[model samples]
Target: MPRFAANLSMMYTEHDFLDRFAAAAADGFQAVEYLFPYAYDATELRRRLDDHGLKQVLFNAPPGDWESGERGIAALPGREAEFRSGIDRALEYARALGCPRVHVMAGLVQPDAKPAEHRDTYLANLARAAEQAAAAGVDILVEPINGRDMPGYFLNRQADAHAVVQDVGASNLKVQLDLYHCQIVEGDLTATLRRDLPTGRVGHLQIAGVPDRHEPDRGELDVSHLFGVVDELGYDGWMGCEYRPRAGTSEGLGWLNDYQGENA
Candidate 1:
């Protein structure tokens, strides 16, 4: 059976973080993922997870300056110090939350930042971050946000993200292939996963139906097909439901049950 993780940050934001986690456990998610949890008390969050018996599948690097629309700063030039500080903070939080993976958000580019310079800056900083995370037994996962959803952000493709991991030369660094973004930027999920799995490039996964960005069901891509393909390929990782619910998250969860069977 494919283990499911609720995206509490987005799907359950209406409630407090701990309360949302309890709700997710009540709804049957064995694990969970989210975009960010910097403001929440890490130890308190851990206590909630312990109470609910939930594993944190994934979470992101500290998003810098949310008011300015700067989602992440790890890739921006002239901000190496800030970026490292962010990584450290994320590691502290990850440890408290018992998380094994951290999604490095390649931040939006500056108006004058050259493409080549930006790439080099991101690679260098990620290498350092990966080295730090490696000692902590955590994998630094790079996420490629689709251009449509996040314009001007560097690193926006699975192939490109894989390349970053290769360039970093840090075994602990890997790629986070979000299916929703992949569908928009590049379809053929099965083929991509097959190609990337052997390299250990795929460290984490997220799913949402295309176009609407809702739960997977009667959508452009078949999540169960992708799940079966990954299972056959011997991939053992949590598939996180990171979609915005069309009505309620629980309503859409029936799709997964129908495809995965009640046994799952």
Candidate 2:
């Protein structure tokens, strides 16, 4: 069976972080991922994970500029220092929360940016970051967010992410296959995953329905079918539920219950 992990950051906002985590536990998830947990106390997060008996599968490196539209700078020229500092902070959180993977997002692309230059910069920085993460035994996962969702983003294709991973040539660096974005950008989910999943290119996974980007039911993705396909592919990683709730996270969770019950 494919392991299912709820992304608490998207799954809850009504309660405190720990409470939201407890809810995921009570709902029967064995692992969870979050987008940004650096602002919270690492010790507290560690305690909560321990209490809930949940594993931390993935999270993201800190954004360079949360405001003014700058997201991440891992591939930006002249920003290596900031990117490394961000990785250091993420390593601390990964240690505290027992996280095994961290996604390094290449932030927005400049309007006149050259692809070759950006790709070279991304490969160099990712190689160094992967070395640091490898020393800690944590995988550095790079993700390709869809251009439709994240306008101006530099890396927005699974092929691009896979190429960067190959260029870095580090065992610790791999691609995070996010199905929601993949469906948007490529549409042929099964074929794409089949091609990349074998290269050991995929380090982590995230999914949700496309179009509205909500729970599986609100869009075209047959998430249960997806789970089955990946399961057959022998992927033993967490499938992160990284979607915005239509109304609330709790309500959206019914989608999982429906799929799990049927697929169970």
Candidate 1 local Cα displacement, residue 192, angstroms: 0.7
Residues 184-225, model 1: lDDT tens digits? 898888889889887777888888889788877757988777
Cα-lDDT of candidate 2:
0.86
Any residue pairs clashing in model 2, and if so which?
A: none
lDDT of 2 by residue, 72-174 (tens): 8987888989999999999988988889898998988878988788777888889889999998889999898888879989888889888888878999999
On lDDT, the leading prediction is: 2
Candidate 1, residue 198: lDDT: 74
Task: Report how far off residue 161 is in candidate 2 (Å).
Answer: 0.9
TM-score: model 1 vs. ground truth:
0.95
Candidate 1, position 205, lDDT:
80
**How many backbone clashes are present in model 2?**
0
Q: Give all candidates' CA lDDT scores.
A: 0.84, 0.86
Worst 10 residues of 1 by lDDT: 255-264
* Over 4 Å off, model 1: 110-112, 262-264
